[model samples]
Target: MIKLVIIGSGNVAQHLIQAFAKSKEIKVSQVFSRQKETIIPLLDSSKITTNFNDLIEADIYIIAVSDDAISKVSSQLPFENRLVVHTSGSVPIESLDNKNKRGIFYPLQTFTKGKDVDFSLIPICLESENDSDFDLLEKVAKTISNNVFKSNEKQRKALHISAVFVNNFVNEMYRIGNEICEENKVPFEILKPLILETVNKVMTLSPKEAQTGPAKRNDMQTIEAHLDFLSNKNHATIYKILTQSIQNNGKEL
Candidate 1:
């Protein structure tokens, strides 16, 4: 079995614990967290501790901490020359302490609190300084997920940026849709099927090919009607800008 030690108590760490729970090949031997109470609900008291000095011997030490704290956390490890990895998309493997072997095991997905995610669907992006270390990382990753990709820091950062545009920015657009619905006393649930269908269409079609709306058709009359209907200046400005963008295909919108 591949023994593992996880450091952190946040959504990523907690989710990892749950994913590894059913794995026969990988065992989470111990989890270190300053806020031990926060992780105790997921792991037993025997396997969770606040002291880094009390860390158990493991094949891999997974630091699932924040990006800023990754270097600091790796530097604080009492042992050296161990295979240590961090779960960060943007942070490079060089950010780890040189005392030990460094690698990255970034799971490309937004982990929300109190929500269980299907780890099998998550894309596990792996990077390491050595081929041997990468093999170990990939082995662990495959136990929970089949979608594993070998990515360097630059590629990982690009993926993260694209994810932000597609996931985070798209969510903001949904929020704006909700606000517009509320302002007009329209039921937001009524739009859920349309939203789902739009998503389904994009699965088999390019976003540009799937695009359909007054903006895509360059219907200026309908665009102006939408702008005039929106009372919020911010919403109107955003609508006009986006409509122009769609019509111009990103040319001088």
Candidate 2:
């Protein structure tokens, strides 16, 4: 069995704990956090430690802490022989000291505490300092996900940027739409089907091919009407930029 110690107690930590618990090859030997309150009710009665030196011996230590805390927490670890990994997408694995084996086990999916995660469907990005470490990382990743990729630090960084665009920015757009609906007395639920369909279409069609709107057709009249409707400065700016982009791409409305 692969003994694993998890560090952190946030959303990502909760998701990983449940996923690892379901795996037959991996066993969570301990959980480490600075505050006991942060980890209570989420972690089982396995070895829990607040002192970094008191952390139990494990073959692998998975750091699921905040992006800002990774390097600091990693530098304080007691063991040098065990493999250490972080789950941050933007943070490079090399930030950790090179004295021991270091790797990244990033899951390319948003995590919410108490929310169910379909681990089999999520893609796992695996990277390591050397071939042996990479092999071990891949083995551990394959247990949780069928879609695993050997991504280096640079590629992972680029992928993270894309995620911010496709996930974070897209969610912001949805929020703007909801706000607009509320201001106009339009029920936001009216757009739910359209939103779902838009995402579903992209699964079978390229985003450019799935493009359908007045902007895609270069319908200046409709575009102008939309701008007029969106009086909010930020929303209007976003609309104008996207309209110009769609027209530039020559995508049919």
Candidate 3:
């Protein structure tokens, strides 16, 4: 079994612990957290600790903390020349402290508390300085995910930015839709099926092919109506910008 140590107690860390703890091929040796109380919900109290010196020897040490905290946390690790990896999309592999074998284990998924994540569907992006370590990361990744990818720093960074546009920005659009629904005294649940269908359509169709609605048709009247309907200045501006983008993309076809 591949012995692994996980650091941090946030959403990514908790999800990693949940997934790895159940995997047959990987063993979670220990989890380090700043506060035992915080991580107690996800891990056994006995296996979770506040002291780094108390950390056991494991095959891989995954630092799942925030991007800004990665360097500081890795630098503080007491060990050296071990397989130390960070689960960050944008942070480069070189960001890890030079004392150890550096690698990245980025799971391209939006992790939220209380939401169940199907590890099999989430793509695990792996990168490492050493070829052997890359294989090691892949081995651990495959235990949880069928979709494992080997990506370089530039490619991973670009993927992260694309994730922001597709996941983060799209989620913001959903929020705006929900806001409009609430303002009109309609249940946001009414749009759930449509949202699900739109996502499903994109799975089989190119985004351009999947495109529909007034913007795609260049219905200026409908676009103006939407902008007017969004009384909030920021919301109106966002609608205008996205509508412009959609029509511009349509023009390309």
In the range 28-70, model 3's lDDT, one tens digit per residue, is 9899999788888877789998999999999999999999999
* Per-model lDDT: 0.93, 0.88, 0.92
The runs of at least 3 residues in candidate 1 whose Cα sits more than 4 Å from the true structure, single-residue gaps closed, are 250-253
TM-score of each: 0.95, 0.95, 0.96
Angstrom error at residue 213, model 2: 0.4
- In model 2, the Cα lDDT at residue 248 comes to 81
What does the lDDT come to for candidate 3?
0.92
State the number of backbone clashes in model 3: 0
Can you give the lDDT of residue 126 in candidate 3?
94
Model 1: per-residue Cα lDDT at residue 247: 85
The candidate that achieves the highest lDDT relative to the unseen native structure = 1
In candidate 1, the residue pairs with backbone N, CA or C atoms under 3 Å apart (3 or more residues apart, or in different chains) clash, namely: none
lDDT (0-100) at residue 246 of candidate 3? Answer: 84
